[model samples]
Target: MEVNPLNIFFVKSDSKGDRLLFRYPYTTENKDESKQKKYGRHNPYAINSTEDLLQNPQSQTSNICKGQLSGFTDEMLSTLFAVKAELCNRKFELKVNDVRFVGHPTLLPYRTNKDDTATMILINIVFALQASASHSVVKCYYDLSKRLGKALRHEEKRCSYLTEEMKIMLAAHDEVSVLDSEMNGDNDDDDDNLRHSVSSATYSSENGADSSPKSAFHLILQRSSLARSMKSVFEELSSTGIVQVRINKWVLLSFCLPHKAHQIHNRGLIIEPETIDKCLQKLRPYHGILLMVNPNELLASIPLDSSSALLRLIKLYSPLKSLQTLAIEADLTLKQVSQLTGHLVYWAKATVIYPLCESNVYVVAPGANVHINSPLVEEFAKEFPGLCLLQ
Candidate 1:
């Protein structure tokens, strides 16, 4: 399954304080810049933004719970920064009102200025997932968050990217605050009451109302490079299990979501050297071959620069061509061809079988299930339209 995240938040904490620097699917009530005036200072949810209510379709279904998520995120700041030093650089998890937040919190050394040498800053990349998400799914997202955290740390150390971005975001917040104050004017009392009412109603509800005000403060992040990267990562990873994002023209981050395991293998299983030799002996260059599965996905999981040879080999592969024949056609050596086929089998991309021929004999295993009325009968008929199941 693809990784579907409700939201991805980048939280940073330093000597000053903790703040959410960026969040993906930068949400706001108003999609039009002209509507910016509609959102009063008391109601923080009002903003002029490019995106609609939510960009992610999967996340749109949870629109009703946006307020709960907002409140939970506010509460998460303290929880994320309050952890002991022992818990740093580890996965942090929290569940509230059916939403699960998984984050990797790491403390990295940051050079304060030209004068000061350096100091440690706590930063976390958090992924919001559904409560009923499977263990493997959660694990996949957690792994992604951990990788992102590490990448951010590396970039921060290299060129102070995180620090510069934070400064920009904070400046935006300050500017927005000033504008809000000017627009608010003498209506401060009325706005304060409205704000109080909104906050109180949002936190007290069961289904969770739209906690707009708190989220309004974060609208400044909509134009940030980090926010754009987060949106790209979420959309690409959710649609295809792989994503490549370039940050600040400094580093290119490529990640492939690990395949989910359906069944556990035997931990005690072992193969002796003689058994290995026998298997290798059976794998001969004279044997005809065909790919059991499509090689496109396997190719996508590898580096882009190294996929040309594999692509050529797969294009030339056929049941009629022996391994040696394929090597000659693909302009590769016999050893290289053999090793590629072995890698395919080891990675479950293909299966070694006797080449199909008129003289080849086929038999059913003793343990094979041959139930005539089973669902497999229909599936088999659909797969091979002219073939009889019994034959």
Candidate 2:
């Protein structure tokens, strides 16, 4: 099953006064001050912009019960519980400073010590669940436009830096998505991240809703915001725990694609048989690409673009082909090959020949062609015979 990217926020209460400092970029939009003061009996404070959490981190005496937290819907809690249960069942071992899954080095300061905060709790949850699960990991996707609008009012320079960081993050995610499709051939079909406003709101409702006594007094968040990046969120969460720390040294580098990338990182149109035929008809006037389809030989059609070296690579493609093998055949780096394959699979709607075994020597087709007597592969071969299959 596919899991949507997880968004977790940690807020610390102000030690100095009744006001709370938002460790995360909490939203103040769609909130009416006067009406809230009249109906809710209190005026909502503007989101705190201070970066230093130590100045006023939440303490035991802090009044966090006064609607400081929100967005804890039943669905979200159920998912979190399910994740936790799975980790326990698997007996997955995790430590507070475990940095195996996290890409950024300096983004995490708990490597040497521990901090008693919601940030540590959520991080452990995300990391342990990811380690235990086979097909999901937590991800953060931000909407730059909305974030800039909110940040511009408070800090211009910080907003500018954030913009650049987001660009790099998006690019990195896209790259990972492409690589995942090529390697795993898994189809991720959920679009939970891009749906709706994706914002969590704070609400104070009646008592009978939760099992915990504190639930009635605690603030409830409905959803998460797209205004802050994962890095930003983590930084703020650790603000109180770590002192005088600068996250400038942390930089995200290219890494192995996660299991969730295949579904979320799709591009190009999935062509139907009729559409394939129409594309073939358009290509009838050309002679460079040849089309041949045969199932008896256990080989699909040979639809090779006559002029493209990349197409030639696919025609003779095998996952077993080493870097040396590729180099001997064509002057292409691994990155170049990966980029080309990404275009072919995602943009061209090519079939991926997934490995059926651990050694990757045995291979099988997609679920649509799982059964031996299934006609899907033959029909697929007939439509566009020379299309490349990812292995």
Candidate 3:
């Protein structure tokens, strides 16, 4: 299943107020052009286009323009900040119209150089998903956000990585503001130099080049390890189910979307050791084993030490041979073979059955699906061309 996030935002709060530290896919200069194409000029939230709101007053209160931070309005930001106490140290889901905000708010204790005591800082890494997202997909993104939040908290506690990165981001924000003002004035030469510096810094940072502190403001922000991590989490986890990111160049953290319970039902099975042992002991030497799954697939998941033995067992396995004879041929003790069979059964890889004999009675399993329209019927017909399933 595809689990793509519309946008990602890192919000931080302290005694001052809530601040949007950084967001992925930075707001471009052509935001207005793209906004028109995406939401159309009729969107109430579109930049400088108020006709939609004037025409439909209800939409002004209900609908939000889509794309990046366009949907994230001041009202939503205030609501999030007002519930800071409830949002801290827990998972939060805030829905506004068609957008759903999911995040794990983490509270970290930070200390400054002058002060020996620590102050609490609330940080949340949020993913914006469509409200129509499936429960499983939402859960996956939530898990990813939770892991990322915890990792940042750990890094902040260990080395003040988050604190330092935020400072750099704030500085970059200030630099952008100054540049905007300068560009507004008639200084064509200065504007060209600033543009060149921004592009060069961005390219250098993206290519893993070491950028100095005095580099362009864009470089300072994108050069942050935390920023790169946020980008990686959004892009990688959405495309693939797994993500591995290095934190502050010191620790490597890995997170993955867990498989649903039904996909790994055998792993969840609980059987008493006494019952398993009794079942193993009751197995007759004349009984044969049948593999339910491909041996090659099982070999990939099993340990290397046991893989060779398993392969040998598969090569020697035969429904016509007694358990004792099969074990002898496979160069395995009868007890060892019985133990192996028990493990396979526990994993739902194989099952024990009687050898083929005319005297043996066969019947459909009680839980088997006997419907004529069942896919099993088609498979059976394909396997046996002339056989009549009803007969």
Off by over 4 Å in 3: 29-55, 58-70, 73-82, 113-117, 186-221, 258-391
Clashes of each: 0, 13, 0
Give the TM-score comparing model 3 with the true structure, all chains together.
Answer: 0.53
Cα distance off (Å), candidate 3, residue 119: 1.7
* Per-candidate TM-score against the hidden true structure: 0.57, 0.25, 0.53
Question: Which 10 residues in a row give candidate 3 its minimum summed lDDT?
Answer: 258-267
Query: How would you order the candidates by lDDT, starting with the best?
Result: 3, 1, 2
Alpha-carbon local distance difference test for all models: 0.63, 0.30, 0.65
Across residues 1-391, which tens digit of lDDT does each residue of candidate 1 receive?
2235777777777788787666665555332232465552555676755766556544333422543244434435555544555777887887665667788788888777777488888878887777766675677677778887788788988888877777767765654444445444533687765755554463335224633333433544454677677778877765544567877666677764423211112122322324334565688877765565555665566655665777788877778778888889999998888777765654335555666677878787655456887676777799799885776
Estimate, for each residue in 1-391, the C-alpha lDDT of model 2 and write its tens digit.
Answer: 2222222322111221111111232333212342355456443775746679658765343212222323333233223323222232122222222111211111111111134231111111122122222322322111211222233222323333332333333333343334334323344444422221121111113234432212211222111122233334344322311111122332221121222223323322223324333443332111121111222221232232233656555555554454335444666655555444444433232333332236646435343343545665566567768852321
- What local lDDT score does residue 225 receive in model 3, on the 0 to 100 scale? 74
Give the worst 10-residue stretch by lDDT in candidate 1.
260-269
Better of 1 and 3 by TM-score: 1
